[model samples]
Target: MPTILMRYRAAALLGAAVIIAPLSVAAFSAHNVAAAAPTLSASPNTGGSFAPIVSADKPAVVTVTTVIKAENAGDEEASPFRGNSPFDEQFRQFFQDQGIPMPDQSPEPRQGQRAEALGSGFVVSADGYIVTNNHVIDKASGITVTLDDGTQLPAKLVGADPKNDLAVLKIKPSKPLATVGWGDSDALRVGDQVLAIGNPFGIGTTVTSGIVSARGRDLNSGPYDDFIQIDAPINHGNSGGPLVDAQGKVVGIDTAIYSPNGGSVGVGFAIPSDQARKVVATLMKDGSIEHGFIGVQIQPVTADIADAIGLGQPEGALVAGVNGGTPAAKAGLKAGDVINAFGGSPVKSPRDLSRMVADLSPGTSKSLSVWRTGQSRDVPITIGRNTGDQQ
Candidate 1:
């Protein structure tokens, strides 16, 4: 595996680079303060200004190596010569055509195959906290993190959220660690320049630059799939590394790419820093995140459904089904009820409601405003943990 970050195809070509969209940076710079003048001998060394942000973050990036132990053989593995296997009919036809006898299936099982994979991660805290993609460590019995200095450490799983494809890790580093500063991902706009740093294909730490192609993108990672789409070069080993902005702050975590040839396609996906930080915090503090549930399967009311319901315009999430004893059902919520408000946040669509519920604290009661039977009313529902058993 290469450890360097892959280069974006479009941006690297020098001709296909997209326009950089102007972003609102006022809010992001609101906390900037002027430093007091130094009293004596020499001027303090101010951090050098830079355009790409991955300059200082490279040290915090690490290469993750995983070992998979597989069984050598199965007790009773299915034979390729039997049943619906393509080789079954071919074997039978071959014997019939060539006038040769076919061998009987053996009772013994076949041998198994083992595979090893590599990925990347970034340090988020100096105390040995790291973040990476859950899929990178999935089913991995052993994991090792290799720093830039050739130092290797055994990492333990702090917590993992498969729904969002994220995992938290803790390494027992004997020395102080370098960590990346978090950025305001919400402040990033489409076309903003970004830098991606990671170990791609087991290569040493590599840095690639590109622009944010889009924001609030949904790659079906989960209900809260608001990702930042970038035209950065991201490959197999880039998963879980930081997507830094121009200020050397981590704005996102590189996760996936839209590719058919198993290579960079100039379209990479990353989890926003805002959302990732929340997951990291929950994993660090409570070892798990407690998701809020509204207990209703809602769909955005379309024109047809709105007309059928006699509503003048289509809006809000239409309750398609309600859990029998869930909080929504207990609050008199029924199918066809249009949810317009969750707590005080506007509910524009199913995704909106899903985000609202997920961001709320579990067991906390929230107010919902719904339109039903030509009337709007408020209903209270106590949010519940997802528990992985319910929608």
Candidate 2:
């Protein structure tokens, strides 16, 4: 949806993370300090029956159905054969008079001529809070959630962080809803077992198993795109579903898949839970996140660029451009300056710097370790908020 990346939103097996909070990242009251939500994890040694894990987590997974206006749905199949629809009702008569017998074809269900967009989500709180991809409900006129027990409920959008492609919805269930616990995604290694549960192609809930194919996959979707790559066969309608770990805890949020042929080719991506925890917690309070920003364009410091700049080694982020009146400019940061560190932590790459700056709160002051003119120096700066107005 955002380039060749197919967003597993709507009805296709294609689509489309960093973007992780490090230890130094600010903390939040993500959840109340109470008893942990009951997560029924099955014995990993159970010799191949994931039924227990599925049974425990399935209750928390819900199907997210969204309704978009016809004009924006981009799914009009009026049929060129008809020679009418957008043309005119009068054209239909004219085309009919030509006696062009239409071939026998079953009428396409107006499939939401209102554009019914289907995706998946999971219950994160017993109080009825849900997490899904922003693309799932993007531009939707109405949203509905169907629980595991077949109970349908109208949902309200609590908040959405589109930069992360994550949205939080609130539904009022008659009783406390079943919930899933967050898992540590950082601990997952290649070949570690994981399960993806969701409604692929609007088919009833299904579960697929695979190993962690890779990690830190950046699809160039965005700067905060540190993704968990898995060969779990996620397809359309799996967007926003939870990627569960062996312990039955939610480790990642299924968001996109890699498919050049319009279906899963054993490659899928999910947002790490560590990052989602902070964003979701904030969304639960504020309607959106005020991401930290400093008007500076950056690129990785390749070895050639580093040598030319007289740096000891290829490292840190090189300032390519600095916006005027922005924090970087105000701090006297100029092109050719290499940001080696922030808040005393090494700024290893552009992606690293991106996640670092984004983790800080606006107005929070920090010192940047800058390598300029063959010398290292510290430039103090105040983090600014990216209000979509400022660069």
Candidate 3:
């Protein structure tokens, strides 16, 4: 098997990044205002201690608390037997005739139950823009950010990109807020020293130290599944926290951890800062991102399949199925064909192609290199709006 494809079987990405104990979602609200792109800066840590970096960046890191509405709860109290049906009324009447005391039938003001949850986030701009995971504030009825000084402020959703598992939040503060700058995730190498800071289990802010274990990990969460794998002990409430480097710059966002038990097992996944910076910039400006979609089911070309098709290498994404009336179908991309390159970029695996395609904007036209019938050819195609990212 190809080494790239083997990673999927070796260990699942933590969405393939999983949180054994899921962080609570269900908070909600959107703000009409948008902020400009974030300003980036970093103060390197020279001392052996992580104290300097922490001291510089910790102020920007925050605890995200959310009040989410319970979907199962209702607005008013009603008898359990009083369901929405004529038969339910008859059943209640029957119970009344039997001299049985039924549950309360009188309507009372039963407010929708709200669940409180905690996670972590970091300020990206001095103007009060914050970066966190989409899952952190997903479905929240209200959101709050607690600063390091213990000041709490209301937060509003600016925009969210679930495919990337990221969201942007806005808070109007009285003054400029402390901010952590973005670092180059592409520069991160395996074994590089790093720090994971967050409010694990909602017990205030905590910091963990580790190295970048791996890069370009596909958790299989979605099309844009590339993540940085780390050995830091990121836990439940660390969901949207920042993964910093010795340079004191934000390099990744702690998202999920792989554990059979509900704790960190030395396996954690983070959204690369390079990716997050782009998404955050777009969200702050446009309020959302529209991923490009091509309607096709794909799988990595295994060695066996490669040999069968006389392909010298098991690389690129193999077309498994194509949805009709979609971009792939319209481009005459057929089953059994292999997509070796997309928009001039080499496709090393299905994951690579997925990430590449999703990075494209809808209505953008690009050339796709296809291998078919013992030959290769380039095909022109236009990207389509992703009504859904499944394509």
lDDT tens readout by residue for model 2, 171-250: 98887777877788889998999999887766577899999999997655456778898998786678788888887878
Clashing pairs in 1: 1-201, 1-202, 2-200, 2-201, 2-202, 2-203, 3-199, 3-200, 3-202, 3-203
Report each candidate's C-alpha RMSD, comma-separated, in the order given. Answer: 12.6, 11.1, 14.3
Deviation (Å) of 65 in candidate 2: 0.6
User: Where does candidate 2 stray beyond 4 Å?
Assistant: 1-37, 75-112, 389-391
Count of backbone clashes for each model? 10, 14, 12
- Show the lowest summed lDDT stretch of 10 residues, model 2: 16-25
Looking at candidate 3, the ten consecutive residues that score lowest on lDDT are 20-29
lDDT of prediction 3: 0.70
Report the lDDT of model 3 for residue 286. Answer: 84
Query: Which number leads on lDDT?
Result: 2
lDDT of 1 by residue, 204-228 (tens): 6778888999988754334777878
Which one wins by lDDT: 1 or 3? 3
Candidate 2 lDDT for residue 244: 85
Q: Tell me how far the alpha carbon of residue 96 in candidate 1 is from the true structure, in angstroms, after superposition.
A: 42
Q: Arrange candidates by lDDT, descending.
A: 2, 3, 1
